[model samples]
Target: MFLDEHTAKQQIVAFAKSIFDRGLTSGASANMSVRIENAWVMTPTNTCFGFLNAEELSVVGLDGTLLKGLPPSKEFRLHKAMYDQRPNDRCIIHLHSTYATALSCISATDNSNVVPTFTPYLTMRLGPIAMVPYFAPGDDALAESVGKVAAKHAGIIMANHGPIVSAETVESCVYGMEELEESCKLALLLKNENANTLTAEQINFLLNKFKK
Candidate 1:
């Protein structure tokens, strides 16, 4: 079920603080949006996740008009693109978390699925992560690129930037983002080792069993 605006604001603020308190994201480098009927209650532009004010959160109509509160995130298009493609998803979180951003800075062998399946949680929660080529932050082109892959990816790693995760609820979106970060950490940690990544069959089984 979609959240009502008030609860969406509270959930956004609560989870944003939770993420920031845990060092999942730093400063004003992250943003989140939650679907509430025909509009989205989103974090305001330049607001730190740790310091969000629920009463001051922005609300944008589904067509992208600002309906209330402070201005929505400058990267609002990124969230819009994903919401448009994933109709069933109610929340989207984009973070510049360290490990995931570090992974983004590297050249991925497969941009279609950047993170390797070092563990099942990432795949179970986010499926394959698409890596969009770098575009300056807030560039509409970045949103366009994200739109191209959002339908197939519940999670994405923007090159030279970081990860964006979406889910049917606030909790799932946060957990998926954490899983993405953890997966990136494991991938970097075992980069030089002969890590026995999960095989194709195993990954497919997970995709079928856990993904909707």
Candidate 2:
């Protein structure tokens, strides 16, 4: 059955609160959205994630019309880009998580800044993450850049912007992003240390063991 807009809005709002209470979104810096009828349901523009209400959420159709509530998140284009590029993505969680955002500021396309280290947990949850270059907030350029990487990842780090996770369910999307942040935090901690990075052989072994 199709999701009633209000129900989906509430879920997104609840998930946003969870993200904020866990110190994910800070101030008015992050937003959340879910796909709906060729459009997207998202938290309101300029609202704090910790206090979002369904009624305050907005709906933007595929053609970019504001069909319900207030104006949709400033990153509607970002959501649209993912929807367009990734057919399986039903929800998207965008946040300015501290550790992940910190990693974004310094990460590169190379696995070194991602989950290259020997960690089965990160590999299982993130699969392969992507790092997109920074773009001005709310610019179509950001969406365009995201389109190039969406097909390659379940989670993406917006260099200097934060992270966005696209998944089949809102819950899984949030969980995956939490894993992404934790893995990034671990990577940051081991920076410059002699901690053994995950070798191709070790990663392949784990992959084969778990069929990941």
In terms of lDDT, which candidate is strongest? Answer: 1
Q: Candidate 1's residue-wise lDDT over 1-212, tens digit each?
A: 88899999999989999999999889899999999999999999999999999989999998889999999999999999999999999999999999999999999899998999989899899899989999999999999999999999999999999999989999999999999999999999999999898999999999999983
Deviating ranges (above 4 Å) for candidate 1 = none
User: In candidate 2, what are the lDDT values of residues 66-132, reduced to their tens digit?
Assistant: 9889987788889888878877677888888888899889847583235555577766665767788
Listed per model in order, the count of residue pairs whose N, CA or C atoms clash below 3 Å is 0, 1
- Clashing residue pairs in candidate 1 are none
Pairs in steric clash, model 2: 118-198
lDDT score, candidate 1, position 198:
93
